[model samples]
Target: MAKGKLVGKKLILLGERDGIPGPVMEACLKDSGADIVFSVTECFV
Candidate 1:
């Protein structure tokens, strides 16, 4: 597994679902070892 240091950074993921990430997006972020601070989804508009 690839690993890196993420001490004080913010990650904002905006999508259509909650607690579920898209495959491609997940893979890219996983490779970078980012610390996800926020994950949000839009319900309408």
Candidate 2:
């Protein structure tokens, strides 16, 4: 992965069930050098 803009930043990822999921986003950012405070996937009707 290329250098991430989130390097050394803290984040909270909120994902949607119909969209990108939280865990998936986390995986993408795992190597971004950011501290993920939390990740959640919310479902909507």
lDDT of 2 by residue, 1-45 (tens): 447688889999999999999999999889888999999999977
Tens-place lDDT digits, model 1, residues 1-45: 545674345567765555455443545675565766566556543
Q: Top lDDT: which candidate number?
A: 2
Deviation (Å) of 9 in candidate 2: 0.5
RMSD values, in order shown: 5.2, 2.2
Predictions in order: lDDT? 0.56, 0.92
- Give candidate 1 regions above 4 Å deviation: 1-9, 17-28
TM-score of each: 0.41, 0.82
